[model samples]
Target: MSAFSRFTPLIRALPSTVPFVGPEAIERQRNLPVKARIGANESGFGPAPSVLAAIRARAGETWKYNDPENHDLKQALAVHLGIRADNIAIGEGIDSLLGLIVRLVIDPGSVVVTSFGAYPTFNFHANGFGCRLATVPYAGDREDLNALLDAVKREDATLVYFANPDNPMGSWWEADDIVAFTRALPETCLMILDEAYCETGPASAMPSMQALIEQPNVIRTRTFSKAYGLAGSRVGYAIGTPGTVQAFDKIRHHFGMNRIGMVAAQAALADQAYLHAVVGKIKKARERIAAIAADNGLLALPSATNFVAIDCGGDGVRARAVVDGLMQHGVFIRMPGVAPLNRCIRISVGPEHDLDLLAEALPQVLKAL
Candidate 1:
C-alpha cells in the first residue's frame, strides 16, 4: 500500500522509537510472563485503599467529560502544596506537560539543554518540536548542574529539563544546590525541574516550594505516579508563577484529565496518613533491593528514588546479559541507556515475593554468565 504523501516536515524527519518499553510489550515480544513487575519505575506497592474506593465511587461519573478547567484537582493540589490554585496547571502527567511546554517555547531549530542520559521522554518531546539538543554528560553518575548551566548559556537554549532524585541511575542532589542552580540560570532560559521522584527521596533532597514558586523561568513538575502509586492515573501538575503557568491554559488539552484519575488524586492527597505509610514501605523496599544486589556480589548505588541501580561489575555488555538473564526467569527490570550509567541495571522496589524471585534468579543468572 502507498503511504499518505501529505505530512509535516517535522513528522517526516522524526524516527519511530520507544523511549522506555513497558513490561507488557516485553511479554508479547519475548513470550514470557513477568513474575516480578519491577521495571519502568512503577510502584509495585500499589495505590492506597482510599484511592481505590474513590475510583469506585467516581466510576459512575466516567460518562461525563472531566472539567476542562480541572478545577477541583487544582484546588486540592494547591491546598496540599500550600500554594494558590492560580499557581498550578494540571496535565495527564509530567510527560504530557513536557510536550506542552516544548510546544509553547520551542520553534524549529531552537536549542534545548538536558543531561546526556537523563529522562528520554523530555528529549523525545524536544525533538518532536524540532529543537536542537545540547546534552551535558553526567558527572560521577549524577547530572552535572554546573555543566548544564554552562550549556544553556553557550547554546543560548530556550528550554532545559532536569529531574531531581533522578531516574535510571537514581542519583540526586541536595535541595540547596538545586535552588542555587535555578537562581544561576539566565532569565531567558526556561527550566523544567522534574521532581517525579521527590516523595521517595529524603527531605533534604527536595527544595522548599516557596524557594522557586515565584520564579517565572522555573516550573517544577510533580506526579502521583511514584510514591502515591497512581501511575495508571496519569495525573501530574506543574508549579510556577501565575503568569508563567497561565501559558499552559492557552495550549493544553482542555479536557485531557480522566475523571477517575482526578478523584483518585484528590482522595490520595486527603489521605496523607496512607502516603506517609507507603513512603516508609518504599524506603524499606529500597533497602531490600540493595541487600539483594549485595548478596549477588554487585554494588547497589545510593538511591533517593523508589528503584536501586545495581552496578553489575562490568561494562554495558555484562549488565545487559544480567538484564536478559533475569527476564528469562520472569524477573523483569531495566538498565540505563548510555555508558557508565549502563554498567548498572535498574530495579524497582516490589513486595517481598517479587524480591524473592529476584534473589533467586540473580545469582543463578550470574553463575550462568
Candidate 2:
C-alpha cells in the first residue's frame, strides 16, 4: 500500500540507518546466540545493588510520569559535581542530547565537524538535520584535535563533536591538551565534549569540571551508562553555562526521564563506594582483554574506556573475519568501521567467564584465518 507522502524534504532525503547494529539485532539476523556480550561498550559488571533496590522500590510507581524538571537528579548531580543545578540538563542519554544540541544550533546546510570515524551517531544526527559534515582523520589512532579545530575554522562550522576516552578505538588525550583545545576553538562554534567514559579513564585524561563548566561554547556530555552500569536506564546529563543549558528546556522532551531510571541514577550517585569498586573491576577486566590479545600475538591499544581495541595486524577484511568467527562460537564483539582504525577489533570488559569464552574463541578464529 502506498505510504503517506507528507514527510519533510530533509526526512525524505536522508537514508534510513542506525549508527551501530546492536548485538540483539545480530542475534536475530544471524540466528546465533551471544555468549559473551561485550561489543557495545556496555558495563557487564552491572549496576550497584543499591541501584537495583532503588529501582525495585520505585517500580510500583512507574505509572507516574517523571518530573519534567528532573529536579532531584539535577540536584544530586549538582552536589556531586560541585556545580549549580541550573547548570545541568538531563536527557535520555548522550545520544539524545547530541541530537538536541544539533537541532538547537544547526540549520539546513550548516556545517558540523567531527573525526572521520569517531562516534557515528553524531554524524547521523547532523545528516538528519541536513547539515554538511566536515571530517578529520585520526592522527596516531586518536582524534586529531588540531585538525578538528582547523576544520571548524575552515568550514565556519556551527557544531563540533568530540569524545574523550573515545569509543571504537578507545583513545584519549590528556586533560591539559583538551583544555587547550577548548580554549582554542572559535567562540561561534559550539563544542560537545562527549565524556561518556570519563569515570573509567585516568584522572589525567579528564579536564577539571571548573575548567570548562563556565564556557558557553562548551557542553560536556556524560552518562550513567559506562562506569555506573546504567546503560539501560538511558540517563545522561549535559554541563555548561546556565544560559547555554537553559536552551534545552525550550526544546527538550518535558517528562522524558523515566521514574525508575531517575531513582536508579540517584541511588547510583549516592553509592560512590560501589562506583569505586566497579571501576577497579573494570581496570582488571581491561588488563585481561589486553593480555588475551597479547597471547594471540595481536597488539591491544591503550584504552581509557571500558573496552580494548585489539589490532588484528591486518586490514579490515581480516579484522571482520575474526569478528564473524568469534560470533560463530557465540562470543560477540565488534570492530571499527573505517580503515587503519578498522584493523582493530573492539571488545568491552566483561566478567572472567565471558573473557574465557573470548580467549577460547579468539585463537581458534585467528588459526582458521
Candidate 3:
C-alpha cells in the first residue's frame, strides 16, 4: 500500500480507524442479510408521524441551504430548554461538534481526559489532533467520575469529556453529582458534557439548563439521535455561553445543516407528546430485554439509557463468542472494545420482533458454545 508522498507528519503518523462498524458493513463482509437490525442504538420505533409529515412537506424545499445562523431551530430549542437562543450552536451532529471542540482547545500533546471505554468518537477526535489522552477505568460498570476528576487534575488537562446516561455500559450519574463535578473542575479545563442519552435517563440524572450555563468553560452537547429517532438526520446542538458558542463559528461548516434534517429536528422538538410515547415504548422494550436475558441466565446491568449491558459471566473472549454467535443467527449485536468493559455485551432496545429474535436465538447460541 503506497501512501501519498508528501502528507503532513501528523497525517502520516496517525493510524486509520473507524470508531464503529455498522451492521451493513458486517452484512456485506459475510454475504448475509440482517434479519433483525438491533445492533446499532438507532430507534427502531423511528421518528414521530408528525416528524415524517414535516419531512414530506419540506422535501421539495431541500433546494435551499439551511439558515447558517440556525435562527429558528435555536429559538424552538431555547423555548423548550428555557435557555437563550444565543446559547445554542447547531452542528451536523455531536461527532462533528467533538472534532470542533478538539480543534478549539487542543494543541499537539495537549491532555484530554475521558473514561477508558467511554464514547470512542471523542477518543478518535483527540487522536486526530495529536492530543494526549488520560483515561480512568470504569468502576463496577459505571464511569468513575472521581477517578476521571483525579486524572484531569493530575494531567493538568485542557479538556475533559463526560457522557451522562452513557453509551455501551448504559450507566449514569445523578444531576447534582455532575453539577458538583463541573464546579470542582479547574477553570482552565473545558468540559464537553455530552448528553446524547439524556431523554432516556431518569430526571435526576440530568442537570438543569441553568445548572452550568454561566460557565464559559462548560459546553454541553445534545443530539436528536437517541430518543428523538433522528440519528440519520445528524442534527445536534451545543449549549454554552454566547462568547464560547461563538467560537464554533471559527471552524464549523456554516452551511452543513441540511434543510430536511433541520425541519425534522424542529418537528421532533415540537412533538413532545410523541417523544414521551416512544420513551414509554423504550422502557417497556428495556424491561423485555432484561426479562429475556434473565430467562437465559445472563445478568442485565442497570441502565438509565436505552440499551442494556449484560455481564456474560466470563472474560472478553466469552463476550466475543456471544456477539459472534448472535450474528450467526442473523441477530446483529455488539460488545465493548477493550478488556474489563469487554467482559459485557451491549444490546440496544428495539422493536418486539427484534427482541423476539434475540430471545429465540440466545439459548441455541449458548448451547452451540
TM-score of each: 0.99, 0.99, 0.98
* Root-mean-square deviation of Cα positions for candidate 2 versus the true structure, in angstroms: 0.8
Tens digit per residue, CA lDDT, model 1, 1-369:
687998899999999986889989999999999999998888888999999998998799999999999998889888888899999999999999999999999999999999988999998999999999999999989999999999999999999999998987799999999999999999999999999999989899899989999899999999999899999999999999999999998999998999899999989999999989988988999999999999888899999999999999899999999999999999999999989789999999888899999999999999999
lDDT of 2 by residue, 1-369 (tens): 697899998898889899999899999999999999999889899999999988988799999999999999999999999999999999999999999999999999999999988999889999999999999999999999999999999999999999998987889999999999999999999999999999989999999989998799999999999999999999999999999999999999998998899999999999999999999999999999999999999999999999999999999999999999999999989998899899999999998999999999999999999
Pairwise lDDT winner, candidates 2 and 3 = 2
Best candidate, lDDT: 2
Question: What clash count goes with each model?
Answer: 0, 0, 0
lDDT of each: 0.93, 0.94, 0.92
| Candidate 1 Cα deviation (angstroms), residue 68 | 0.9
Residue 236 displacement in candidate 1 (angstroms)? 0.5
Name the better of 1 and 2 by lDDT: 2
Put down candidate 3 lDDT per residue, 52-159, tens digits, no spaces: 999999899999998999999999999999999999999999999999999999999999999888899899999999999999999988888899889889999999
Which stretches of candidate 1 lie above 4 Å from their native place?
A: none
The residue pairs in collision within model 2 are none
